[model samples]
Target: MIKAILFDYDDTLVQTRKTRYQTIYKLSEELFGTKITEKEIDAAWGLPAEEFLLNLFGRFSSDIHYLWSIYIEFSKKDLNIPHLNAFDFIDKYKNFVKFGIVTSSSEKVVLRELNELRVDTNLFLQIQTSDHTAVHKPNPNVFEPIFALLKKENMNKEEIIYIGDSPADYESASKFGFHFLGIAHDDRHTSYFQTGEIPFVRNFLELEEYLIDQYSFI
Candidate 1:
């Protein structure tokens, strides 16, 4: 029986595609003096911000902070774009199933968005954010603490499932032996995750269908 469900932030629970696009576009122009296309932003979206910056510009880049600051400032303003249907749908399971959120976003930003969106933070049993771990998604370290927490709750990996909208999220779940559900928050990102043949749903309504079909209610 499933005892827990973990969710990913950003596109998985909220709409941040335009915010990501704008941030990457501005950073590309300012940092590299060249513009990045929408495809580039989608490809880099799964990567940690600093890791993506270093991978693209290497260690010699002088203003990585400037790029990140601009990105965060713009992203913060994007909190008002709400997608609460997923939360409402999940609430049915929330009563009997433990809920947690694991995301690459920083704690402050996630909290700000949650409050602005009127999402009660207390609904989740745990919320793991970027600031909580040095390593980000696609790396198991970010999820290690989460697993430990669930383990302490007497839930094994098989009893927990992860739902996310990015390749990193899928990869990490696979590496750690958790069942994974992918959401096509963005076509391009979903395409990337689909390459691995992970199961997917386009929206929370579809997700509700999936849960009804694949999982039994407690």
Candidate 2:
């Protein structure tokens, strides 16, 4: 009786790690004349934007805004197509449960990518982003807004699922009382969930199967 599903936008819904790595690589080279390596980016992956920058540069500066602008422009060129039948998955389950986007990304970034992918935003019951919440992931309060929304719909916490790709996503959702499903896209993500004994699926096809078989959604 899962009544709602809250999705993490970036790595979960769309394939963004490469695009993000490229953006950071090019930005570092263009501005600071430093070439950031993929290994470095991977280490900082899934961190909040500011924290990601801090982890990379080891310092905070006004240039973070400049970097963000360039990142957004680069992202505009990246289409960031939905991963593994994500649009199809949404369409298939929209009637079965309320769909929402609960992400640590800003609305500006999320909306642009969603538009570029041609996803029908109307299909979601809500799209809550970092801009909509005071705190971000790893902080359980980040889920309060959506939790409240579900409560208003008379949905129980046990009946809501939050699908994401990072340990932080799982931590926050589980702490906030929602079931969490990891959407592991690579060995790194896979290992994280496996180590934590968390349930996950590699792609939307697996997700579709998991939902039907485990939840009797069919």
Candidate 3:
């Protein structure tokens, strides 16, 4: 009876690591006069952009802000990356259920990518961006507004599930009492599951199978 599915935008639906890592590397080089390796940036992937900057530099400064601006500019110039692909199962079942994207990314960039990819916005009942809510992921506040939108549309919480690739995504789903499907194809996600707090799958194909099994029981 699941009526809707909420997806995380970055690593969940689209391959964003390459672009993000490259941007961070460029930023690091510009701000610190040193190149940041992909491994270091990858380690900091789940953090909010500004927090990631602070974590790398140890303090906030004008140069960090300038670098961020440069990264944003770079992100805007090109949205295409080599490995980007929508989840195949989701694409196949696109018409079977309502869909939405919930992410901590800025609305501008999210919309830009969605438009670039030609995602059918009409399939979604609601799309929540970090800027639209007072709190970001790992906090229930992000889900609260989404729930309100669902309730207004007369949808039930039990009829929804959230799929994401981060531990924070699991935390958000747990806080909102939504079923969680963890996507762990990357090392960052694999490392997160080592803590043993949640169950995870290697990719969306595994998620498709897991959902079929879980729903069969319901």
Candidate 4:
């Protein structure tokens, strides 16, 4: 029945390259006293921010809490909207199904971008962020809370699908037995398609069409 669709917000909903560039550069300069290049930051984009920080900075004595505070403050100010177009078909179908955003980003950053983009908050039944779940993508624990939330609404796992732009997302969906849609075209997303573990679409337009076709039978 696929009563709901869960989305990954960063590279899936909006382009992530520029936002990563700005946030990484600003944080590196402030924390390390040196500017890190975009190329370096891009390499760390798919992983958790804290893991990325630790990898770059090593285990510093400073509490992770302080580092995250700085990262969030920098990200909020630097976030930029990328070239985005509405999945018009999905927009049309919204009334027929539930939708939500599940991302590795914090709620603050997600809310800020949603507000800036003027995406209707009412469109999503739930917004699950990394902060809400102790485990991030590639970890089934993150999906557990989402399932619990949806179960409370009488939704079954079979009646949901997850769409995202990374290999970790594909792995998460597989672990949870949810249909996975991998967003290809971006280099960051190519691994999912190349592995052929999940179906892939080039863009939202293609995804919208695929969904329309797939759901027509129902």
Which pairs clash (backbone N, Cα, C closer than 3 Å) in model 3? none
TM-score of each: 0.81, 0.90, 0.80, 0.84
User: Candidate 2: which stretches are off by over 4 Å?
Assistant: 50-65
Q: Which regions of candidate 3 fall more than 4 Å away from where they truly are?
A: 30-32, 37-44, 49-69, 77-88, 194-197
For model 3, the run of ten residues with the poorest summed lDDT: 80-89
**What is candidate 4's TM-score against the reference?**
0.84
| lDDT (10s digit) by residue, model 4, range 91-149 | 67678888888888767677877787777777888888877877888886778877887
The order by descending TM-score is 2, 4, 1, 3
Candidate 1 residue lDDT tens string, 1-218:
78998999878888766555665566667656887776655556666656665555454464777646665676665444645487786666678889999988767667877887777888898999877788888886678888899999999998988998877888888788999999885586766766767799988888877876898746
Positional deviation of 150 in candidate 4, in angstroms? 1.9
- The window of 10 residues in a row where model 2 has the poorest summed lDDT is 58-67
Question: Best TM-score goes to which candidate?
Answer: 2
- Residue 19's lDDT in candidate 2: 71
- Give per-residue CA lDDT, model 2, range 1-218, as digits (tens): 78888899888898887577776777677766887888888787766666676677654345777657767776676567678888898998788789999887777888888887788999888899867877888999998888888899999999999999888999999999998899987776788888889999988999988987887764
State each model's CA lDDT, in order.
0.76, 0.82, 0.73, 0.74
Worst 10 residues of 4 by lDDT: 81-90
